[model samples]
Target: MASFFAALMNSLDIALLLFIIAIGLNIVFGVLHVINFAHGAIYMLGAYAGYSCMAMLGLPFWLALIVAPVPVVLLAIVIERLVLSRIYDRDVADSLLLTFALMLILNESIRMVWGTGIYVIDPPAMLQGTVTLFGNVTYPKYSMFVIVMGMLVLAGLWWMFNRTRVGHIIRAAAIDREMSQLVCINTRFVITAVFAFGAWLAAVGGVVAAPMRAIDPGMGDKIIIESFIIVVIGGLGNFTGTLLGAIILGLIHGFGSRYFPEVNLLLPFIGMALVLLFKPYGLMGSGGR
Candidate 1:
C-alpha cells in the first residue's frame, strides 16, 4: 500500500513535467500551425544552461531556475523572426523538414558547447530530503516542488489564454489567422511571441528536470518522443487537451511500468494508436479549423 502511494506521487511528478513540455508544443501548433522540431533542443539547452549557472557560476539553484531559460527564449524569438517566419505559409512537410534540420543543428551545437557527456544537478538543500506518507512511503521534497511549480504554470497559462489581452490576441490568431490579421492584429508578432513563449516553457521544464534526471545531449530525444505522443493524444493545438493527454500518459507510464513491466514500453504508443483510431483529432480536439 505504501509503495503504491509512493509510486502514485512519483507518477504525478512525471506527468506534470510532461505537461509543461507538451503544453508549449500545443500552444505553438495552436497559434502558428508549425510543429517545432527544435523544441526538444530548446529543452536540452535549458537543462545545460541551468547546469552551467549552478555549477560554473556558483549561482544558487533557485536563481539558476529563474535565469537559465531567458537566453533560450530570446533565441527562440530570433529563430522565429529570421527562419520560421519564412516557412509559415509553406507546406506542413516543409516546415517539419526545416525544423528537423534546426533540431540537428541545435543538438550538435549543444554537444560542442557542453561536450557530449551526462550531467546532473543536486536539488537545493531545502528540498533535498524526503517526507514520509501513508505510514511508510517516502517521497522526495524536490518532486513536491516540481509538482507545485507545474500547477502554478498551468494556472498561469490558463489565465494568460483566457483573461489577458495578449491571450485574447493569441486565441484570435489560433482561431483564424487571416481573420485576426484582417481585424488589425499583428499576427506576425503574435506568432513570434507565441513561439518564444513555447520555447520558454520547454526550457523551464528542462531546468526543473535537470535535478530529477540525468542530463545529456540525448535526453531531449527521449522526452521529445514522449512529448509528441502527449500532444498527439491530447489533440494538436488544444491546450486543455494537452493537459489531459499529459496526465493520462503520466498515469499510464506510472502504473504500467510497475504493474505491467513487460509491456510498459509499448503501452503509450498503443494508447496513442487507439486514440488516433477512434477520435482522429484526439480525445478533446475539435475538428481542425
Candidate 2:
C-alpha cells in the first residue's frame, strides 16, 4: 500500500509535466492547425539554456526558469515568421515535414553546442529534500513542487482561455481566422503569438524537467514521441483530453515498469493503439471542430 501511494505521487508529477508539455503542442495545433514536430527540440534547447544559466552562469534555479525560455521563445518567433508563417496555408504534411527537418537541425545544433554528454541539474536548494506523507510514505520535495507548478499552470490556462479577453481572441481566431481578421483582431499577430506561446510552454516544461531528468540531446527525441502519443490519445486540440491522456500515460509509466516489467515499454503504445482504434476522435474529443 505504501508503495502504491508512492507510485501515485510519482505518477502525479510525471503526468503533470507531460500535461504541461503536451498542452503546448495541442494549443499550437488547435490555433494554427500546424503540427510542430520540432517542439521537443525546442524543449531540449530550453533545458540546455536552463543548464547554462545555473551551471555555467551561476544563476539560481528560479532565475534560470525565467531566463531559460527566452532564447527558445525567440527562436520560435523567428520560425513562425520566417518559415512557419509561409507554410500556414499548405497541407498539414508540409508542416510535418518542415518541422521534422527543423527538429533534425536543432538536434544537430544541440549536439554541436552541448556535445553528446548527459548533464544533470540539481533541484533548487529549498526543494532538495524529501517529505513524508500518510503511512510514512516519503516523496521528493521537488516532485511535489512540480505538481504544484503544474496545477498552477492548469488553472492559469483555464482562466486565460475562459475568462480573459486575450484568450477569447485566440479562441475566436482559432475558430475562424478570416472572421477574426474581418473583425480587426489582427489574426496574423495572434497566430504568431499562439505559436510563440506554445514554444514558451514547451521551454518551461524543459526547464522544469531539467532537475528531474538527465539533460541530453536525445532527450528531446524521446519526449517528442511521448508528447505525440499523449496528444493523439487525448485528441488533437483538446485540452481536457490532453490532461486525461497524460495522467493515463503517467500511470502506465509509473506502474507498468514497476509491476509489469517484461511488457512495460509496450503498455503506452498499446493504450495509444487501442484509443486510436476505438475512439479516433480521442476520449474528450467530439467529432469535428
Candidate 3:
C-alpha cells in the first residue's frame, strides 16, 4: 500500500511537469493559431541556461530558476515580432514550415553552444532529502516541490485567464480577432504578447524539469512530440483542456510504465487516436475559429 502511494505521488509529479509544458502550447495555439514548432527548443534553452547559471556561475538553484527564463522570454518576443508576425494570417502550412525551420536552427545553435553533451543539474540542497511516508515508503522532497510549483502555476494561470483584463482581451482575440479589431483592440500587440507569454511558460517548464531530467540536445525533440500530443489531446486552443490532457498523459506515462510496460510507449498515441476518433475537435475544442 505504501508503495502504491509512492507511485501515486510520482505520477502527480509527472502530470504537473507535463501541465507546465503543455499549457503553454495550448495557449499559443488557442490565441495565435500557430503550432510553435520551436517551443521545445526554447524549453531546451531554458534548461541549459539554468544549468549554466547554477553550475558555472555558482548561483543558487533558486536564483537560477528565477533568472534563467528571462532571456528566452525576450527571444520569444523578438521571434514573434520578426518572424511569426509575418505569417499570422497565412496558411497553417506556411507557419508550420517556418517554425519547423526555426526549430532546426535553434537545435543546431544549442548544440553549438552547449557542445551536444548530456548534462544534469542537482536538485537544490533543500530538496535533496527523502521524506518517510507510510512505514517504509519514501518520497523525494524535490518531487513534492515540483508538485507544489505546478499547482501554483496552475492557479496563477487560472487567475491570469479568468480574472484579469488582459486575460479577457486575450480570450476576445481568440474568439474573434476581426471583432476585437473593430472594437479597437490591437490584436497584433495581443498576439505578440500571447506568444511571448507562452514561450515564457515553456521556458519555466524547462527550468523546472532540468533538475529532474537529463539535459541534452535531444531533449527538445522528445518534448516537442509530447507537448504537441498534449495540446492536441486537450483540444487545440483550450487551456483547461490542456491541463486535463497533461494530467491524463502524465498518469498514463507513470502508471503505464509500471503496470503496462510492454505497451507504455504506445499508450499516449492510442489515447490521442481514440479521443480524435470520437470528439474530432478534442475534448474541449470548439469548431471554427
Candidate 4:
C-alpha cells in the first residue's frame, strides 16, 4: 500500500510537468497550424536560464523561476516574426521543416553555451528535503509544488479560454482565420501572442523541472519525442485532451517502472499507438479546423 501511494504521488508530478510542457505545443498548433518542433529546445533553454540565474548570478530560486522564462518568450516572438511568419501561408510541411532546422540549431547552440556536462539544480532551502505524510510516508515538497503549479496553470487556461474576451478572439481566429479577420480580428497579433505564450509555458515547465531532473544537453532531445507523443495522443489542438493524455502517460510510466521495468521505456509508445489505432482523433479532438 505504501508502494502504491508512492507510485501515485510520483505520477502526479510527471503528469503535471508533461501537461505544462506539451500544452504549449498544442496551443501553438491550434492557433497557428504550426508544429513547433523546437519547443523542447526552448524548454531546455529555459532550464538553462534558470540554472544560470541561480548558480551564476546568485539569484534566489524563487526569483529565478519568475525570471527564467522571459528570454525564451522573447526568443519565441522573434522566431515567429522572422522564421515562422513566413511559413504560415505555405504548406504545413514548410513549418515542420523550418522548426526541425531550428531544433538542430538550438541543440548545437545549447551545447556551445552550456557544454556537455550534466548540471544540478538544488531545490529551494525550504523544499530541500522530504515531508512526512500520513502513515509516515515521505514525499518531496518540490514535487507537490510542481503538481500545484500545474493545477494553477490548468485553471488559468480554463479561465483564459472560457471567460476572457481575448480568448474569444483567439478561439474565433483559430476556428477560421479568414472569417475572424473579416470580423476585424487581428489574427497576426493573436498568432504571435499565442506562440509566445506557448513558449512561456514550455519555459515554465523547464524551469520547474530543472531541480527535479538532471540537466544535460541531451535533455531536450529526450523530451521532444515524449512531447510529440503527448500532443498526438491528446489531439492536435485540444487542451483538455492534453491533460487526459498526460495523466495516462504518467500512469504508464509509474506502473511500467514499478512492475515491468524491462519494458519501461516502451510503455508510453505502446499507449500512444493504441490511442491512435482506436481513436485516431484522440479523446476529444474535432479533427481539423
**Alpha carbon lDDT of each predicted model:** 0.91, 0.93, 0.89, 0.90
Backbone clashes (count) for model 2? 0
Candidate RMSDs in Å, in order, are 1.1, 0.8, 1.3, 1.0
Candidate 2 residues 1-289, lDDT tens each?
8988888888888899999899999999999999999999999999999999999999999999999999999999999999999999999999999999999999999999999999999999999999999859988999999999999999999999999999999999998999998999999999999999999999999999999999998999988999999988898899899999999999998888678889988999999999999999888888675
Model 3 per-residue lDDT at 72: 92
Best by TM-score: 2
Please tell me which predicted candidate would have the highest lDDT against the true structure. 2
Comparing 2 with 4 on lDDT, the higher-scoring candidate is 2
TM values, all candidates: 0.97, 0.98, 0.96, 0.97
What TM-score would candidate 2 get against the native? 0.98
Q: What tens digits encode model 3's per-residue C-alpha lDDT throughout 10-125? A: 88999898889888877898899898899999999999999989989999989988899999999999999999989988999998999999999999999999898899999999
Model 1, position 80: C-alpha lDDT score: 91
Per-residue C-alpha lDDT of model 1 across residues 1-289, encoded as one tens digit per residue = 8768877987898899999998998899888888888889999999999999999999999999889999999999989989999988889999899989999999999999999989989999999999887888888999999999999999999998889998999999998989998999998888888998999999999999999999999998888889999988889998888999999899888888888899999999999999999998898888773
lDDT of 4 by residue, 175-257 (tens): 89999999999999999999999999989899999999999988888778888888778888998999988998888887778
The list of candidate 4 runs beyond 4 A from truth reads none
Cα displacement (angstroms), candidate 1, residue 101, comes to 0.5
lDDT of 2 at 43: 91
The positional error of residue 282 in candidate 1, measured at the CA in angstroms, is 0.7
Predicted structure 4: lDDT: 0.90
